[model samples]
Each structure stands twice: as structure tokens, then as C-alpha cells.
Target: MERKCNNLPFLLLMQTSKVIHNQIKEEMAKNKLGITEFSV
Candidate 1:
């Protein structure tokens, strides 16, 4: 239904954010950057 369709993007965004966040963390650790810098 319409509700289920709307939920798809939200779920996708959450999944994508998790992946990006982890990737950023890895990159920050590799270069020794702070959480604030990685967030920005």
C-alpha cells in the first residue's frame, strides 16, 4: 500500500547511512581524524 511504499525510502536511507558512517569511521581512523571532523 501507500504506507509500505513510503517506508521503503526511510529504510533505504537508514541502511545507506549506516554504511556511510562506518566508511567514514574507517577513513578517519586511517588518517587519525576526530569524530567532529568526520561528522562534518
Candidate 2:
């Protein structure tokens, strides 16, 4: 239980980042921009 609690924040952060990343990808696609282009 202690170990799982310690890792919970990291796991949540990863999941949140993934969600944000997918949203960014979708927005970029709608704008007809590739990931490389969008990053710049």
C-alpha cells in the first residue's frame, strides 16, 4: 500500500500527459499541421 501510494502521482501525471498529447495531436491534424511543424 505504501509503495502504490508513492507511485500514484507519477502514474496520474503520465495519464494526464497522454491525454493532453492526444488532444494536441488532434488539434494539429485539424489545422493540417504535422507534429514536426507544430513543435516549431
Best by lDDT: 2
True-structure RMSD for candidate 2 = 3.9
lDDT of each: 0.87, 0.89
Task: Please give the distance, in angstroms, between residue 38's alpha carbon in candidate 1 and its true position after superposition.
Answer: 4.2
Residue-level error in angstroms, candidate 2, position 1: 19
* Cα error, candidate 2, residue 37 (Å): 2.4
Which residue pairs in model 1 clash with each other?
Answer: none
Q: How much is the lDDT of residue 5 in candidate 1?
A: 50
Tens digits of per-residue lDDT for model 1 on 1-40?
3545568888999999999989988899999989888667
Candidate 2 lDDT by residue in tens digits, 1-38? 35454688889999999999999989998999987899
Candidate 1 displacement at residue 7 in angstroms: 1.2
In order of listing, the candidates' clash counts read: 0, 0
What TM-score, over all chains together, does every model reach? 0.66, 0.72
Best by TM-score: 2
Backbone clash total, candidate 1: 0
Alpha-carbon shift of residue 25 in model 1 (angstroms)? 0.3
